[model samples]
Target: MLNEHAKLLALFKQTGEIIGRKKLQKMVYIAKKMNLPFNEKYQLHMFGPYSEELSLRVEEVCQLQFVSEVKEKKGGYQQYRYELSEKGEDFLSMMSFHFPDATGMLEDMNHKSSKFLELVSTVLYFEELPKKEVAEKVFKLKAKQNYSEADLDEAYAYINRLHQVAPKKGAYS
Candidate 1:
Protein backbone atom coordinates (compact mmCIF):
# COMPACT_ATOMS: atom_id res chain seq x y z
CA MET A 1 0.00 0.00 0.00
CA LEU A 2 1.19 3.51 -0.74
CA ASN A 3 1.28 6.33 1.79
CA GLU A 4 -0.87 9.46 1.43
CA HIS A 5 2.14 11.60 0.58
CA ALA A 6 2.98 9.30 -2.28
CA LYS A 7 -0.63 9.30 -3.36
CA LEU A 8 -0.72 13.08 -3.20
CA LEU A 9 2.42 13.33 -5.26
CA ALA A 10 0.87 10.98 -7.77
CA LEU A 11 -2.21 13.14 -7.90
CA PHE A 12 -0.12 16.24 -8.51
CA LYS A 13 1.80 14.48 -11.23
CA GLN A 14 -1.40 13.27 -12.91
CA THR A 15 -3.08 16.61 -12.55
CA GLY A 16 -0.12 18.30 -14.15
CA GLU A 17 -0.80 16.23 -17.24
CA ILE A 18 -4.26 17.70 -17.70
CA ILE A 19 -3.54 21.16 -19.00
CA GLY A 20 -6.23 23.87 -19.53
CA ARG A 21 -8.89 21.78 -17.76
CA LYS A 22 -10.30 23.16 -14.52
CA LYS A 23 -12.71 20.69 -13.03
CA LEU A 24 -12.17 18.81 -9.80
CA GLN A 25 -14.39 15.98 -10.93
CA LYS A 26 -12.23 15.49 -14.02
CA MET A 27 -9.10 15.71 -11.93
CA VAL A 28 -10.59 13.16 -9.54
CA TYR A 29 -11.31 10.88 -12.47
CA ILE A 30 -7.73 11.19 -13.71
CA ALA A 31 -6.51 10.51 -10.18
CA LYS A 32 -8.68 7.42 -10.11
CA LYS A 33 -7.14 6.23 -13.37
CA MET A 34 -3.74 6.68 -11.69
CA ASN A 35 -5.06 4.48 -8.84
CA LEU A 36 -5.29 7.26 -6.29
CA PRO A 37 -8.21 7.42 -3.86
CA PHE A 38 -9.74 10.89 -4.03
CA ASN A 39 -12.79 12.35 -2.37
CA GLU A 40 -15.27 14.07 -4.64
CA LYS A 41 -16.13 17.08 -2.57
CA TYR A 42 -13.29 18.76 -0.72
CA GLN A 43 -13.58 21.21 2.19
CA LEU A 44 -10.50 23.35 2.40
CA HIS A 45 -11.28 25.22 5.59
CA MET A 46 -11.74 22.17 7.75
CA PHE A 47 -8.52 20.83 9.23
CA GLY A 48 -8.11 17.07 9.26
CA PRO A 49 -5.72 14.34 8.22
CA TYR A 50 -7.26 13.64 4.86
CA SER A 51 -9.35 16.35 3.23
CA GLU A 52 -7.78 19.27 5.07
CA GLU A 53 -4.26 18.23 4.34
CA LEU A 54 -5.15 17.69 0.71
CA SER A 55 -6.77 21.11 0.64
CA LEU A 56 -3.71 22.77 2.11
CA ARG A 57 -1.47 21.13 -0.41
CA VAL A 58 -3.74 22.26 -3.19
CA GLU A 59 -3.87 25.77 -1.81
CA GLU A 60 -0.13 25.94 -1.57
CA VAL A 61 0.14 24.91 -5.20
CA CYS A 62 -2.36 27.59 -6.15
CA GLN A 63 -0.38 30.17 -4.18
CA LEU A 64 2.49 29.51 -6.53
CA GLN A 65 2.85 31.73 -9.62
CA PHE A 66 2.33 28.95 -12.13
CA VAL A 67 -1.04 27.82 -10.79
CA SER A 68 -4.51 29.33 -11.07
CA GLU A 69 -7.59 28.72 -8.94
CA VAL A 70 -11.29 28.64 -9.68
CA LYS A 71 -14.25 28.03 -7.38
CA GLU A 72 -17.54 26.36 -8.02
CA LYS A 73 -20.57 25.44 -5.86
CA LYS A 74 -22.94 22.62 -6.58
CA GLY A 75 -25.53 20.97 -4.37
CA GLY A 76 -24.23 22.43 -1.10
CA TYR A 77 -20.64 21.58 -1.93
CA GLN A 78 -17.81 23.94 -2.76
CA GLN A 79 -15.15 22.91 -5.25
CA TYR A 80 -11.81 24.54 -5.80
CA ARG A 81 -10.08 24.06 -9.10
CA TYR A 82 -6.49 24.55 -10.26
CA GLU A 83 -4.83 24.89 -13.63
CA LEU A 84 -1.38 25.79 -14.88
CA SER A 85 -0.69 29.47 -15.42
CA GLU A 86 1.06 30.77 -18.54
CA LYS A 87 4.27 31.19 -16.62
CA GLY A 88 3.92 27.65 -15.40
CA GLU A 89 3.18 26.53 -18.93
CA ASP A 90 6.21 28.38 -20.22
CA PHE A 91 8.32 26.83 -17.49
CA LEU A 92 7.12 23.41 -18.51
CA SER A 93 7.96 24.14 -22.15
CA MET A 94 11.46 25.39 -21.36
CA MET A 95 12.15 21.99 -19.88
CA SER A 96 13.33 19.64 -22.65
CA PHE A 97 14.03 16.84 -20.24
CA HIS A 98 13.27 13.33 -21.47
CA PHE A 99 12.02 10.32 -19.59
CA PRO A 100 13.80 7.08 -18.60
CA ASP A 101 14.76 5.59 -21.95
CA ALA A 102 15.25 8.85 -23.82
CA THR A 103 18.99 8.48 -23.48
CA GLY A 104 18.85 5.04 -25.06
CA MET A 105 17.03 6.48 -28.06
CA LEU A 106 19.69 9.18 -28.33
CA GLU A 107 22.38 6.53 -28.39
CA ASP A 108 20.54 4.41 -30.92
CA MET A 109 19.99 7.43 -33.13
CA ASN A 110 23.64 8.27 -32.82
CA HIS A 111 24.68 4.77 -33.89
CA LYS A 112 22.12 4.58 -36.69
CA SER A 113 21.94 8.23 -37.64
CA SER A 114 20.72 7.71 -41.22
CA LYS A 115 18.01 5.26 -40.24
CA PHE A 116 16.81 7.44 -37.41
CA LEU A 117 16.87 10.50 -39.65
CA GLU A 118 14.78 8.68 -42.24
CA LEU A 119 12.26 7.74 -39.59
CA VAL A 120 12.28 11.30 -38.34
CA SER A 121 11.62 12.51 -41.88
CA THR A 122 8.66 10.16 -42.04
CA VAL A 123 7.47 11.52 -38.72
CA LEU A 124 7.73 15.10 -39.92
CA TYR A 125 5.91 14.42 -43.19
CA PHE A 126 2.68 13.57 -41.39
CA GLU A 127 2.34 17.04 -39.88
CA GLU A 128 0.91 16.13 -36.46
CA LEU A 129 1.43 12.39 -36.76
CA PRO A 130 0.95 10.81 -33.36
CA LYS A 131 3.77 9.29 -31.40
CA LYS A 132 2.26 5.91 -32.21
CA GLU A 133 2.97 6.38 -35.90
CA VAL A 134 6.53 7.36 -35.20
CA ALA A 135 6.97 4.27 -33.06
CA GLU A 136 5.45 2.05 -35.71
CA LYS A 137 7.66 3.36 -38.47
CA VAL A 138 10.72 2.99 -36.31
CA PHE A 139 9.67 -0.51 -35.35
CA LYS A 140 9.26 -1.51 -39.00
CA LEU A 141 12.78 -0.31 -39.62
CA LYS A 142 14.16 -2.08 -36.55
CA ALA A 143 12.51 -5.33 -37.65
CA LYS A 144 15.22 -5.74 -40.35
CA GLN A 145 17.70 -5.96 -37.47
CA ASN A 146 17.80 -7.85 -34.17
CA TYR A 147 16.84 -4.87 -31.98
CA SER A 148 14.51 -5.29 -29.05
CA GLU A 149 11.10 -3.65 -28.91
CA ALA A 150 12.47 -1.48 -26.13
CA ASP A 151 13.34 1.33 -28.55
CA LEU A 152 9.81 1.69 -29.89
CA ASP A 153 8.41 1.42 -26.40
CA GLU A 154 10.87 4.04 -25.25
CA ALA A 155 9.75 6.46 -27.95
CA TYR A 156 6.11 6.29 -26.92
CA ALA A 157 7.03 6.19 -23.24
CA TYR A 158 9.09 9.32 -23.64
CA ILE A 159 6.15 11.09 -25.31
CA ASN A 160 3.78 10.12 -22.51
CA ARG A 161 6.37 11.05 -19.91
CA LEU A 162 6.70 14.46 -21.53
CA HIS A 163 2.93 14.77 -21.41
CA GLN A 164 3.01 13.95 -17.71
CA VAL A 165 5.45 16.75 -17.10
CA ALA A 166 3.61 19.33 -19.23
CA PRO A 167 0.99 19.92 -21.89
CA LYS A 168 1.41 19.06 -25.55
CA LYS A 169 2.94 21.60 -27.90
CA GLY A 170 0.79 24.78 -28.30
CA ALA A 171 -1.67 23.42 -25.73
CA TYR A 172 -0.45 25.50 -22.80
CA SER A 173 0.44 28.46 -24.97
Candidate 2:
Protein backbone atom coordinates (compact mmCIF):
# COMPACT_ATOMS: atom_id res chain seq x y z
CA MET A 1 0.00 0.00 0.00
CA LEU A 2 2.58 2.49 1.14
CA ASN A 3 4.92 0.98 -1.42
CA GLU A 4 2.51 2.34 -3.99
CA HIS A 5 2.76 5.67 -2.25
CA ALA A 6 6.51 5.51 -2.66
CA LYS A 7 6.02 5.03 -6.38
CA LEU A 8 3.82 8.11 -6.52
CA LEU A 9 6.57 9.98 -4.76
CA ALA A 10 8.98 8.70 -7.36
CA LEU A 11 6.73 10.13 -10.06
CA PHE A 12 7.06 13.60 -8.55
CA LYS A 13 10.78 13.02 -8.21
CA GLN A 14 10.92 12.36 -11.94
CA THR A 15 8.45 14.90 -13.27
CA GLY A 16 9.12 17.80 -10.90
CA GLU A 17 5.72 19.50 -10.48
CA ILE A 18 2.58 18.08 -12.05
CA ILE A 19 -0.40 20.41 -12.40
CA GLY A 20 -3.97 19.24 -11.93
CA ARG A 21 -5.34 16.22 -10.05
CA LYS A 22 -6.83 14.94 -13.26
CA LYS A 23 -3.46 14.97 -15.04
CA LEU A 24 -1.80 13.04 -12.25
CA GLN A 25 -4.58 10.48 -12.34
CA LYS A 26 -4.38 10.06 -16.08
CA MET A 27 -0.58 9.89 -16.00
CA VAL A 28 -0.60 7.05 -13.47
CA TYR A 29 -3.37 5.21 -15.28
CA ILE A 30 -1.50 5.52 -18.57
CA ALA A 31 1.74 4.31 -17.03
CA LYS A 32 -0.03 1.32 -15.52
CA LYS A 33 -1.55 0.45 -18.88
CA MET A 34 1.90 0.68 -20.41
CA ASN A 35 2.89 -2.26 -18.15
CA LEU A 36 4.61 -0.28 -15.44
CA PRO A 37 4.06 -1.46 -11.84
CA PHE A 38 1.32 0.83 -10.53
CA ASN A 39 -1.52 -1.13 -8.86
CA GLU A 40 -4.29 1.41 -8.55
CA LYS A 41 -7.81 0.14 -9.22
CA TYR A 42 -9.80 2.31 -11.59
CA GLN A 43 -13.37 2.62 -12.77
CA LEU A 44 -14.67 4.46 -15.78
CA HIS A 45 -15.70 7.90 -14.62
CA MET A 46 -16.83 11.21 -16.09
CA PHE A 47 -13.35 12.19 -17.27
CA GLY A 48 -11.78 8.82 -17.99
CA PRO A 49 -10.12 6.18 -15.82
CA TYR A 50 -10.31 7.32 -12.21
CA SER A 51 -8.61 5.55 -9.32
CA GLU A 52 -10.08 6.03 -5.86
CA GLU A 53 -7.15 4.11 -4.40
CA LEU A 54 -4.73 6.48 -6.12
CA SER A 55 -6.75 9.44 -4.86
CA LEU A 56 -6.65 8.21 -1.26
CA ARG A 57 -2.95 7.45 -1.49
CA VAL A 58 -2.28 10.97 -2.74
CA GLU A 59 -4.32 12.35 0.16
CA GLU A 60 -2.41 10.22 2.66
CA VAL A 61 0.92 11.28 1.20
CA CYS A 62 -0.16 14.91 1.45
CA GLN A 63 -1.12 14.34 5.08
CA LEU A 64 2.28 12.76 5.64
CA GLN A 65 3.94 15.76 3.99
CA PHE A 66 5.44 13.58 1.29
CA VAL A 67 3.57 15.48 -1.41
CA SER A 68 2.17 18.98 -1.67
CA GLU A 69 -1.25 19.76 -3.10
CA VAL A 70 -2.19 23.33 -3.88
CA LYS A 71 -5.55 24.48 -5.14
CA GLU A 72 -5.65 27.23 -7.73
CA LYS A 73 -8.44 28.78 -9.72
CA LYS A 74 -8.35 27.86 -13.42
CA GLY A 75 -11.02 29.84 -15.24
CA GLY A 76 -14.27 28.86 -13.46
CA TYR A 77 -13.27 25.88 -11.31
CA GLN A 78 -10.48 24.87 -8.95
CA GLN A 79 -7.36 23.03 -10.14
CA TYR A 80 -4.76 21.20 -8.08
CA ARG A 81 -1.02 21.30 -8.58
CA TYR A 82 1.02 18.47 -7.06
CA GLU A 83 4.71 18.45 -6.30
CA LEU A 84 7.19 16.48 -4.25
CA SER A 85 7.80 17.99 -0.86
CA GLU A 86 11.32 17.81 0.55
CA LYS A 87 10.05 15.14 2.88
CA GLY A 88 8.88 13.14 -0.13
CA GLU A 89 12.30 13.33 -1.71
CA ASP A 90 13.95 12.29 1.56
CA PHE A 91 11.59 9.34 1.98
CA LEU A 92 11.91 8.24 -1.64
CA SER A 93 15.71 8.25 -1.33
CA MET A 94 15.43 5.74 1.51
CA MET A 95 13.37 3.28 -0.50
CA SER A 96 14.97 0.88 -2.98
CA PHE A 97 12.48 1.70 -5.69
CA HIS A 98 13.14 0.20 -9.13
CA PHE A 99 10.97 1.77 -11.78
CA PRO A 100 11.09 2.34 -15.51
CA ASP A 101 12.74 5.37 -17.05
CA ALA A 102 9.40 6.94 -17.64
CA THR A 103 10.83 10.44 -17.54
CA GLY A 104 10.52 10.89 -21.29
CA MET A 105 7.02 9.48 -21.42
CA LEU A 106 5.95 11.47 -18.39
CA GLU A 107 7.41 14.68 -19.70
CA ASP A 108 5.68 14.04 -22.99
CA MET A 109 2.44 13.52 -21.12
CA ASN A 110 2.98 16.58 -18.97
CA HIS A 111 3.38 18.69 -22.12
CA LYS A 112 -0.01 17.63 -23.46
CA SER A 113 -3.30 19.30 -22.60
CA SER A 114 -5.52 17.57 -20.07
CA LYS A 115 -8.21 17.14 -22.71
CA PHE A 116 -5.80 15.21 -24.93
CA LEU A 117 -4.72 13.06 -22.02
CA GLU A 118 -8.38 12.44 -21.27
CA LEU A 119 -8.92 11.21 -24.80
CA VAL A 120 -5.74 9.11 -24.67
CA SER A 121 -6.61 7.46 -21.36
CA THR A 122 -10.17 6.81 -22.47
CA VAL A 123 -8.82 5.07 -25.53
CA LEU A 124 -6.41 3.08 -23.35
CA TYR A 125 -9.16 2.08 -20.89
CA PHE A 126 -10.87 -0.02 -23.54
CA GLU A 127 -7.64 -1.11 -25.18
CA GLU A 128 -8.35 -4.79 -24.75
CA LEU A 129 -10.99 -4.54 -27.43
CA PRO A 130 -10.36 -4.21 -31.14
CA LYS A 131 -9.49 -0.78 -32.50
CA LYS A 132 -12.86 -0.49 -34.22
CA GLU A 133 -14.64 -1.35 -30.97
CA VAL A 134 -12.52 1.04 -28.95
CA ALA A 135 -13.18 3.81 -31.42
CA GLU A 136 -16.89 3.06 -31.25
CA LYS A 137 -16.82 3.17 -27.47
CA VAL A 138 -14.96 6.47 -27.57
CA PHE A 139 -17.54 7.76 -30.00
CA LYS A 140 -20.42 6.55 -27.81
CA LEU A 141 -19.06 7.52 -24.43
CA LYS A 142 -17.14 10.64 -25.38
CA ALA A 143 -19.50 12.23 -27.85
CA LYS A 144 -19.25 15.45 -25.91
CA GLN A 145 -15.51 15.58 -26.61
CA ASN A 146 -16.21 15.83 -30.34
CA TYR A 147 -13.55 13.28 -31.27
CA SER A 148 -13.06 12.46 -34.92
CA GLU A 149 -11.31 9.61 -36.73
CA ALA A 150 -8.30 11.86 -36.84
CA ASP A 151 -8.39 12.16 -33.06
CA LEU A 152 -8.80 8.40 -32.60
CA ASP A 153 -5.99 7.79 -35.07
CA GLU A 154 -3.80 10.25 -33.26
CA ALA A 155 -4.59 8.66 -29.91
CA TYR A 156 -3.73 5.17 -31.19
CA ALA A 157 -0.49 6.31 -32.77
CA TYR A 158 0.32 8.23 -29.61
CA ILE A 159 -0.13 5.05 -27.59
CA ASN A 160 2.55 3.39 -29.67
CA ARG A 161 4.89 6.31 -29.11
CA LEU A 162 4.25 6.30 -25.35
CA HIS A 163 4.93 2.58 -25.11
CA GLN A 164 8.20 2.99 -26.94
CA VAL A 165 9.21 5.86 -24.70
CA ALA A 166 8.57 4.23 -21.27
CA PRO A 167 11.73 2.02 -21.49
CA LYS A 168 11.98 -1.59 -20.19
CA LYS A 169 9.09 -3.75 -18.82
CA GLY A 170 8.10 -4.30 -22.37
CA ALA A 171 4.61 -5.49 -23.32
CA TYR A 172 4.07 -3.87 -26.72
CA SER A 173 6.95 -1.40 -26.61
Which candidate leads in TM-score? Answer: 2
True-structure lDDT of candidate 2: 0.87
Summed over model 1, clashes come to: 0
lDDT of model 1 at residue 10?
Answer: 36
What ranges in model 1 sit over 4 Å off?
Answer: 1-55, 96-173
Number of colliding residue pairs in each model = 0, 0
After superposition on all CA atoms, what RMSD does each candidate show versus the true structure? 17.8, 2.3
Put down candidate 2 lDDT per residue, 43-112, tens digits, no spaces: 9999999999999999999999999999999899999999999998889888876766678788888888
Over 1-173, each residue of candidate 1 has an lDDT whose tens digit, in order, gives 22332333334333443222223323332233222344434321211112344556555556655567766785697655455566555554455542222233222333333332333333333326666665565456445633345654543453344346443333311
Q: Give the top-scoring candidate (lDDT).
A: 2
> How close to the true structure is residue 31 of candidate 1, measured as C-alpha lDDT?
31
Superposed by TM-score, candidate 1 places the C-alpha of residue 124 at a distance from the truth, in angstroms, of 40
lDDT at 132 for candidate 2?
Answer: 93
